[model samples]
Target: MFQGRRRPWAAVSLFATATCLLAACSNAPPPPVVSEPPPDAPSTTTSAPPEQPMPVEVVVGVDELEGGFNPHALADMSPTSSALADLMLPSVFRPAEDGSLQLDTTLMESAEVVPGTDDFTVRYDIQRQASWSDGAPIAAEDFVYLWEQLRSQPGVAEPAGYRLIEDVASRRGGKTVEVTFERPYPGWRTLFDNLLPAHLLRDAPRGWSTVLDDGYPASGGPFAIRQVDLDRGEIVLERNDRFWGEPARSDRLVLRAVDNARQVEALRSGDSHMALFGADAATMRSLEELGDTVDLINMPRPVTMELLLRPDSRGMSDPGVRGAVTAALDRNRLVEAGTGGRPAGQLPAHAQVLSPSEEAYRPTEPPGAIPPAPDPQRVERLLTEAGYERSAGAWLRDGRPLNLVIAAPFEHESYIAIAETAAEQLRAQGIQATVVTPTGDQLFGDMLAADPRSTGTGGAGSVDMAVAPRPAGGDPASMLASAYGCPGVSPGGETPFPYNAAGFCDRLLQPTIEAGLSGEVPFDKVSDEVESVLWRDAVAVPLYQQAQVLAVRKEVEGVRPGNGFAGPFSTAAQWLGTHADDDGY
Candidate 1:
């Protein structure tokens, strides 16, 4: 039923075509017709045979399938495609429970950092037994080819660590690779994450961008693409027989693109085995509506929803005002209101550099030993001290009402609720604030711009505040390099300068951030120093860590909740198929 190539092997020639037309072949004895067993017949064998169970198929629901199958393509780096990449691609390194990078023994036998050089060098011993589904052996050349493409080619959004590699040589007759970096790249483990088969992609005609648009030619992971039907809004993946590791438990996997509103219905009607989406108000209602049909699993996300303020704005330019706003907000109440009154089990965030799930995270607080609670009196004192007076239930500075504009995403339903709640809190303290739901381009481009001249079509003069999610990868240094470093600093200079939307930049902290990113300084020391700056300046106010929620059917098994880059399908090889008679996972 699939409309694409089913397997890597060539089509088989079952019989000789020309000789079958001969008369001698036609005159050969006709095969006798097989007879069926009689209905009343007894057991013919000595004993009755045991019944065999059928192979299982799993259906996973997603928000949409808007991108291509090419994992290397920039457009396919969206959330849905990233989920699919976990099934078809093999990574040499994976994130451990403590948010640290660990080498995957299935792909690499060993990885060690070589010393005694000004530039950093790491040697990776590839597993000789690992091979792609197309039958090509996974070798050092795959890494070399991927590195070359990422460094020289276009379309890759973040090629930071890979660009620093001066050379990648194949030693031990192509079984090992020696990567010598031009600079110290502490996040080297995140590079070459999804290696492509060198034999298929090395000499690609359409280059890296469009080569795999039709579908992957081969896969190194547990599953391979069998069909991609855009019309039906589904992609079917089959177990890859050429996989060297443990084979997948399920026979087939179907990723369905369903709307957020219809996901609960799909699970209850037996159309989907699992679904993960934003825990918004509608999803909360749907979870209550679904009742006992599906189970909801909530986990901490490596993302944070924070209020990013523009220091160049009206009253927000003052550090006292920023501190007052931070003190006025009760993060515990905001967390409950944001997640529909705590059924989702979300946690309030205290630090921006690391999530509570991470081991290196520390609770950052302002100096002077103030209690961590809403202080209305302190808010009035700070406002009155900053050339403002409370008159007619409004704070007026220089004969003008102190008005603040908060921008949030128009598409994210949860963000809208958070913005509304924050606006109400600000207004309760005699500060006039308005929440505006703007497009992503307007929010990220115009409102979050470093220079006012580059504002987008939104025409927003000065954006006082915006609420958005910040991605924190396995390495915190790599994530916070631009935001926490100096005015013009990044990890290996991968991103542009002025990355922090809050416009909080300190020249003294640049060396510390750089040292942390390059592994020259201890992480604990860097974190302590960074926390002091964050708490003292009131750089950004963290609301809560976003929660990744999943709705799974009762019959499904081996559903491991994932954080950071890995999704639910990361451990597909160990997943068991769902059965109708099974009670629960």
Candidate 2:
């Protein structure tokens, strides 16, 4: 369950320096590379469809009713609002699963940071006739407002590119809006790239500098919020006739709030034309048995779930104790108990967001690297040699009993199972690792960067051991950036700018980190190499990468899932039945 209720979004974004570079220039920090387009979808700018087809209907699970259609706040990538957003408010650019940047062109001519010396200002040439749903001109200030909002809003966790840029200048003389940078970074493109509604939002938040709540304001995307049927737990999106981009083929999209019990029943009932996100394995299989076929979408990511240790802490200061704890546990048991995919090795499950061009990854692993299984018995032996011994049936060393308390998110049961089993294995090795569950903000809330012992083995903001799904789609650079390359605060004071969360800060990892951030190679290869190194260090155990399956009725032709973007399917762009042919499904 790699769900993102972690709500405050933290993305491994593009950064830049003060030098101004041309729009299409590949001069950013990472190597210049275009992400691979989704194999299943086509740009609407391609030749017109042989014959225009009818629309499609789709459904998905949403946490709450969307207050607004803006993706900046409303997290409703569910089928309904997304469909409507596409028609009401379309993004100027969208990324493929591989991190390639592309232009929507339907509403804008071109977009990029003003060229020359490589800086943060993003300038775009707008299409002459671009207008809002209310017929207001879509101007450069719209982009300016977005940058301003991101900077001033405290609750809005803006991604990387936005961090470096200081502000957006007026569109007075030039057709472009100049986005100023506060520092040097490589991720400028990720910002100012997503266009906003100038007319409606300009006056929004009390004169444009205000933080726009998650409310779906007047969208310039494909659709706007039609209704959130609270009684039925359903959300519906009708088309936005004023859409500037390719006209959405679909007129309406719907979403429901569903849990394990209703996932299969909802799809089997044919109540939804499409489903976005997948249910658990048992639920997925049951849907399949009901003659519901699902198209699997791959969202690779770099971040991962892990169990890290603060060796310098009171009892674990000895390497033997660390080894003892490591050796006592059976990784396979944890994976089988909860994780659905194969072993993650060292890479996080979600590293799929990085571009292959980053240097962190290698084209291929050498022979003997990336092995599927390792000897579990060897693990036990290693710990014994580390000086841990049985003391009254519990692992003890230096009279401390080798105790480690692991705090995991109570909501995620699978992770709990892993911790529980790990405790059992540690007991066998004469170590005590007590596992506890926490709900509310106390769980994984404040522990992440807090002092290890102060958090007393960590709590809230931190996870002693966590079982999380990697990014749905990304590259190794993305993974390294989040897990290994973080500037995170830790039990041992703050690490240097690039902190290795897993405590794997060998100077050796520096080269790989630079390589990944440099964007020097195709991401796929970069991922392979980076994964190898991370695995070797045991930064975090790579759990399995489960498939995100969506149940579609046989009658649903062209009901393909999206590879890029988020969620199971970014419904607004997909077509139902014969309509899929129009979108080249």
For candidate 1, write residues 1-585 as lDDT tens digits: 245345433333323444456635676787789988899988575776886554477888876665455555433444555666788787889877654678989889988888887778999998888998888888888899888766544334334455557889999978899999877887888777777888887887876656766677788899988877777778888889989988898877877877777887888787788887665666678777888888887656546667776565655788778777776776666666666654334566677677665566677755542336688988888888888999999989889998888877775666778788878888988888998986543455345545423444443336677776665464666656544554442335555432345555567887887788788987678887987777776767777765556788877788776545476778677777664343111
Top-scoring candidate (lDDT): 1
The TM-score obtained by model 2 is 0.62
Candidate 2 per-residue lDDT over residues 273-353, each given as its tens digit: 545442555665565587525443333222234455544345554554554455555656665665544222223332323
TM-score of each: 0.68, 0.62
Predicted model with the maximum TM-score: 1
Q: What is the C-alpha lDDT of each candidate?
A: 0.70, 0.49
Clashes of each: 0, 105
- In model 1, pairs of residues that clash are none
Ten residues in sequence with the least summed lDDT for candidate 2: 1-10
Q: After superposition, how far is residue 123 of candidate 1 from its true place, in Å?
A: 3.2
Which ten contiguous residues of candidate 1 have the minimum total lDDT? Answer: 8-17
